[model samples]
Target: MTTFTVNGRTHQPEGPSEMPLLWYLRDLAGLTGTKYGCGLGICGSCTVLVDGQAARACLLHVGELEGRAITTIEGLSADGMHPVQLAWRALNVAQCGYCQTGQIMQAAALLAATPKPTDAEIDAAMSGNLCRCGTYPRIRAAIKLAAEGGEA
Candidate 1:
């Protein structure tokens, strides 16, 4: 039994220790906000917060997450008003919307660590999250907006 916390709730998922956190989150935990892109951990689509740090869910096994805290996009805020989320929405950053959740999560983690990141810092932090629709510019703008308290 692996005991961990997701979105403030504790879960002792029953399964193989090698079971990927991604599967448990989407399947057993019924939290589908985390997306699956590259199982090889190349894409940031499965990005989530593990103890307040950005991590790839697809690469993490539940067994290794014992006593860890996880936060998906859904758990980011109670009213969907997280600064990053608000900035994303205000900037209209999503195109297809498939990768937005992961992008948002990654951005949130970055903001948590760097409240006001430089443009280069934003680019470096967001390098892992690929936006197929080429919304990189808007994403950068949104991150900056969020860093400034998401007033937009």
Candidate 2:
């Protein structure tokens, strides 16, 4: 059994070792917040936190994740008030809402590593996450808002 921690809970994946972490998370763990956009690791829609850093769940295999700490969007905050999430709500960042969870996860990781990220830094960090609804401006604004302690 490949045991790993997800959302602060231990999980033993029962599928093949090569199964993507996205499947392990959604199919098995029932955490659907992390999406499957392109499945090619280019869209960043399946982003999640692995050991407090943003990782592409579509490309990471379960076998490669043993012992790592995985955090999905659902695990970001029990009260649904993580600063990034709050900022997302405050700035009205979601359009279709399909990609918001991954966007939030990536933003959370960025804010965690760089609490006050500059505009260029925010752009660089959020470059990979694609939003088909074209919410880039709002997303950047929300990131700055979250950094500035703007709560929902």
Residues 1-152 of candidate 2 have per-residue lDDT tens digits of 78899999999888699999999889889998889999999889999999999999999999998799999999999989899989999888999999899899999999999999999999999999999999999999999999999764
Candidate 1: pairs in clash: none
Alpha-carbon lDDT, every model: 0.93, 0.93
Please, what are the lDDT tens digits per residue for candidate 1 over residues 1-152? 88999999999999799999999999999999999998988779999999999999999999999899999988999899999999999989999998899999999999999999999999999999988899999999999999999466
At residue 63, candidate 2 shows an lDDT of: 91
Give me the candidate number with maximum TM-score. 1
- Residue 124 CA displacement from its true place in model 2, Å: 0.3
lDDT over C-alpha atoms for residue 74 of model 2:
93
For model 2, the stretches where C-alpha displacement exceeds 4 angstroms are none
- TM-score between candidate 2 and the true structure: 0.97
| Model 2 error, position 52 (Å) | 0.4
RMSD per model, one decimal: 0.7, 0.9
- At residue 112, candidate 1 shows an lDDT of 96
